[model samples]
Target: MKFIAHINIMPKTELLDPQGKVVVKNLPNLGIQGVSDVRIGKHVTIALEAPSEQEAHDKVELACSKLLANVIMESYDFVIEAQ
Candidate 1:
């Protein structure tokens, strides 16, 4: 079976997002208002082969924990679908 995973990685809420802050600061300069804050994150998509949905889920989780996301600073979530 083939699976496609859509993953989102974001900085932990307790940490400051410098990129998001910069964007928020500049938004007002562009005449944009009413937005109090912003947070930047990463979206990743991967396609892989697995025998079962459970296997695909485990594989994606291992990938996220080992390489894709920084466990200390970033948190990640993923959804896997048949492809």
Candidate 2:
């Protein structure tokens, strides 16, 4: 079986996102208002072979923990689907 994973990596809430903050600070100049506490994140897609959805999930989690996301300051989530 093959699975496709959609992953999102984001800075932890307790951590400050400098890029997001920069965007928020410049929003007013673009006439955008009322949007606050913006946080920026990343999306990743991967396709791989697996025997089961649970197994695929576990693999993706390992990738996230070991390489994709920074466990100290970032968190991640993923969705696995058949392809």
Candidate 3:
């Protein structure tokens, strides 16, 4: 089976996101107000060969834990879909 994995990696809420903060601050200047506490994150797409949805999920989780995200400061989520 083929699976498409969509992953999102973000810094923990307890940590400061300088880039997100900058964007949030700039939004008001651009006439976009009432938005606060914005946090930036990364998105990754991966195609994988697996026998089942569970297998694909496991593979993606392992990849995120080992390489895609910094477990100490960041967290990740993924959705697996048939492709």
After superposition, candidate 2 runs with Cα above 4 Å error:
none
Q: What would the per-residue lDDT of candidate 3 be over residues 1-83, giving only the tens digit for each residue? A: 99999999999999999999999989988899899789999999999999899989999999999999998999999899898
Could you say which candidate leads in lDDT? 1
What C-alpha lDDT values do all the predictions have? 0.96, 0.95, 0.94
Write down the TM-score of every candidate: 0.95, 0.94, 0.95
For candidate 3, which ten residues in a row score worst on lDDT? 28-37
Q: Which has the higher lDDT value, candidate number 1 or candidate number 3?
A: 1
Candidate 3: residue pairs that collide? none
Tens digits of per-residue lDDT for model 1 on 25-82? Answer: 8998989998888999999999999999999999999999999999899999999999
lDDT of prediction 2: 0.95
Higher-TM-score candidate among 1 and 2?
1
Residue 8 CA error for candidate 3 (Å)? 0.8
Worst 10 residues of 2 by lDDT: 29-38
User: For candidate 3, what is the lDDT?
Assistant: 0.94
Listing every candidate in turn, what is its Cα RMSD in Å to the true structure after a full C-alpha superposition?
A: 0.8, 0.8, 0.8
